[model samples]
Target: MNAEGLRERWATLTRCVCDGARLMVGQGNYDTYVAHIRKTHPDQQPMTPTEFFRERQNARFGVGGRGGFRCC
Candidate 1:
């Protein structure tokens, strides 16, 4: 492969690794979400980064100000 192709592959690999690490730590990958939304729901709007983060946090944890995991 050419230098450019090798660099692209390296970059893609690096992004995947970083994304996986973020997931492991309970963080969201906004770019990936946006890409998926754009590809699958072109007519819909994507959330802003802050909104996306909040949405993800609420989905993972509990929504109310109560606390962490909810069992109801």
Candidate 2:
């Protein structure tokens, strides 16, 4: 393969690795959520990143009196 082909392949691999890492760490759901909103709720605007993070945190930790069971 040519040098340009190698560089392209390397870039693609690097991107995939980074995306996989983000997904493993729960930080990559924002894109998926945005896509879902666009597809399922075309009339509704998607939440901003900060808003989305807060919402996810609240859902996971039961913030604001939502009563998520705390083991600790």
Winning model by TM-score: 1
RMSD of each: 3.9, 3.2
- The alpha-carbon deviation from the true structure for residue 30 of candidate 2, after best TM-score superposition, in angstroms, is 3.2
Q: Give the distance in Å from residue 57's predicted Cα in candidate 2 to where it truly belongs.
A: 4.2
Give lDDT tens digits, candidate 1, residues 3-26: 999999999999999999878756
Model 2 Cα lDDT, one tens digit per residue, 1-72: 999999999999998898888655445568889999999999999999999987766665678888654667
> Which residue pairs of candidate 1 clash?
none
- The positional error of residue 62 in candidate 1, measured at the CA in angstroms, is 2.0
Give the range of the ten consecutive residues with the poorest summed lDDT in model 1: 62-71
Cα displacement (Å) at residue 8, model 2? 2.2
Q: Alpha carbon lDDT of residue 67, candidate 1?
A: 62
For each predicted model, how many residue pairs clash, with residues at least 3 apart or on different chains?
Answer: 0, 0
Model 1, position 53: C-alpha lDDT score: 83
